[model samples]
Target: MVAFSTDTSPLPKTKKSLQLGNYGTLMSSQEMPEEYWTPLKLPPEKRVTSSRSDLTSVATDNLSELLDETIAEEQTTIDRVFAFLGFTANPFSSYADDVCNNKASDMRLSMLSNISAAYNAVSISMALDIMQDLYETTSKDKSLCSSALIAGMIVGQLAGGAIGDILGRHMAMAVVMSLQIVGALITACAIQSSFSIYAFIAIWRLILGIGCGGVYPLAATITAESNDDTKDGGKAVALTFSMQGIGYLLPPILTALLARFVPLRLLWRIILGFGAIPGLWLMVLRLKNQIARTNSQVYKSKRNMLTNAREVPVNVLEAIYVEPDLFRKMIGTGGCWFLFDVLFYGNVLFQPIVLSAAFGQAETVQRGAIDSAVVSLLALPGYFASIIAMGHQSPRFIQSQGFLMMAILYGSIGVFFQHLSRHKFALVLLYGGTFFFSNYGPNATTYVLPSLTFSSSCRSTLNGICAACGKAGALIGSMVFVFAASKFGEDIVLLACAVVSLIGMVVTICCVSETVIHDEQIKKPEVRMRVVISEPSLLDYFETA
Candidate 1:
């Protein structure tokens, strides 16, 4: 036990105000009277029990005493605590008091920390549309667009993870968003000029991929840090991920609406350009809120680790190698995500082509119209279903069931596709049915599993890596599906996907634990405190006993 004696005779006090870095205020130290410093004393019986209480109580009592002394030394400490609590209560109001007041400023800072998460679903969905345009423009040149986009995604994810760790989430997001804005502008310009179209699209896509990839880790890190309750953090992350459906929905809707007014070639450009709008808004919010302070601890720790190491400091790659358990878990989850992305992206990207093949050669505009409506409608229910189902089921159970269902559905579709004729309503029903099951399984699981597998410290890095692997699968699917369809037929490609889906289902069931259920089962112990002293003071010691 630690002890300190309070001096009843007051020392000469300085009136100078104290400034706190987090709150951004100058507060007076003379608010509490000198009498508040009367020696904290307890009777002899209580002094004997202090050592036996739980560790948490001892720590809390020690902390309270430290706080009391600090308050006596500087009266503004209580004011700071009150300011902090106020900021914690309501974070989103934009009134001047809310922005400028110390508590409000802290709240706004926390809000900014999480803003990147808010836009992730939108960015990912927009990237898919951009890839679609690239494929459409280069019909004969499929690999160029697919390879470039996939490579961009991989590189961006790696860079984003690294930079996010080094620079802090806000700065990293700002840099990435700036790059995205530039990429969007360049991509839009490239649509107008066909010269070096492949190279131009490739470069822009790579840049945009980096920004998109960077935001995922940044958002994950921010959410982990800002959230006090782990369950709330999980739910918040789950909700953010659920927005991927929104991202998935946006491009097609935008394409459908704008394709009529704009040229098809220019339509994607406008859509891609629109991708920068959210990023720009995020940048502005980050600047206004000054989120750098919340991010400082992470940055400082990373800096010290790098500077103080006698040996070559372990980078993410090295860390993964060192921590094989984490690596395996990440890889397992990532593999499941990969399978999901392949099937999901393959189905989405090739729906028009598949419909056209199923229906036979038809008017291009008519085909586009029918395919667009079918894809759009099928997606809406799946998104809503995902949101509802995500909350009710454990990620492991949902993902496992989803993969099994997807496999069964895809297999059924493959068998039925051969019998269905072009323009038949049954074909649309079959296709839509398959689409609905796609979200039920892998699509929803990929997003939820990452939040569960890792601790808060490395959640973003692990999630980003998993997301990159999923993109890799999408890339492979993009290339393989086109080539396989041209050679073996779409039915064969889908049958293969069904097999892969089953493998994922088995893997998920066998390997992944249900995090939500498991976390709830592990109870945190409650702690109580007992403070003791040999002598009694004028005031009675207020013990919770």
Candidate 2:
């Protein structure tokens, strides 16, 4: 186990290079982001079990000694100042700006990452209405489609996170996007083919889920690294993330519009295939302009494979042993995320049930789609609201406030369920509030925090673990919601959600315990980080020379 340290000395000028402990890198401060020395404010950790992997825990005692010694010798004054200043970033990093000097290229790269961040919601939201055919035809379980997708996401995410750490974020992203497109087309084709369509759909949907889940951690990592420089940077990232609010609305809006003209069966296939568009367009954009590389040395993926492959577990342990309070941070980040998803997905997966309770059955898909769209309208503003709120408020504030508000809303609804039910419009608006607060609160912040908080080498991996916790929550919520509704009615379930949200608020306050109110609010989460080094991040992260 590594001991906690407070050393942050600059590297020796005579010694041109020092091998980063356990990371196997020999980069100097000269190899770091130019802004590392150029007046960019510093940054932001936790612990739990050292075994994040199944591999038997290797002793990190030597690794910890190596870490303390390396940190004492290599960390620059800027890193120390960063820690001293509470790890807050300036409004813009000259280093980040240098990475993509071309305005058009920068915007395209940002947009692509944003699309990646937002599309997971679209993948699932678009298909929910159509997948009902399984239950209708075979008298099978209704949640099969979502469950398959969620399950796929869990597996894909775990694998993708490790892959991102071992390979690179860019490569990992490309592979997942490819999987998403392939999964979409294959699912679409399955319906059109004469084969056992359910089997194919389920299998491909799992594939699609894997793709969707994998991208989320990557998106958050890319966006935060690229944009964590300024308040506007956070705003820009949050705005794109807000697109998820619109993502939830998009499918139903399209369905509402298209269901009038297209056949339901054919329309469903089109919707399934529609998942490919964002990933496809983003891939094309990357291939076209080509993002510039900023590092002095190009990554030799083949040469480093053996080196990086084994480090994933090492980094996971590094986070546990080296980073102060990392265990607690994981608990806070993962726990709050788990709780949020329980409510968020439960509500999302069962929107029809709620609507049916209020307005009777949708009677037709088109009517139901329109109703869904109307409620989702509130969510659009809610997402943008976070962009604005993030510019001024701490994510911790937003997260805690959001959970409390959600609890109040859910409890109020539960207490007066019959009254709200009698007033259908009131119930819909109240329901819509939950979606709004979700995006504005934990939803956006959860995406925001992990990217900015973790060490760059394991950033994607940690984000993956946290995001997987969220999907786990989503899976649990989706699974139990229908059964719980049958047993105790929606009112009891609403009260339970209220309680869960309260637990989330408590998790946010205690687990993510670092609180530093600053202008650059979101960039710093771990102000008291015990172990830090300015190593090259695995993504295309350095400035272009």
TM-scores of the candidates are 0.63, 0.69
lDDT of 1 at 84: 38
- What is candidate 2's lDDT per residue for 110-170, written digit by digit as tens? 3454454344445444455655653344434334555778888887777787677666665
Off by over 4 Å in 2: 1-136, 139-142, 192-195, 290-320, 357-360, 514-545
Which residue pairs clash within candidate 1?
359-422, 402-441
RMSD of each: 13.5, 15.0
Query: What would the per-residue lDDT of candidate 1 be over residues 348-408, giving only the tens digit for each residue?
Result: 5447655675665535433454455556667556644654565456767777887887787
Off by over 4 Å in 1: 1-143, 191-194, 228-230, 262-268, 285-324, 345-350, 357-370, 516-545
lDDT of 2 at 192: 35
Candidate 1 at residue 485, lDDT? Answer: 82
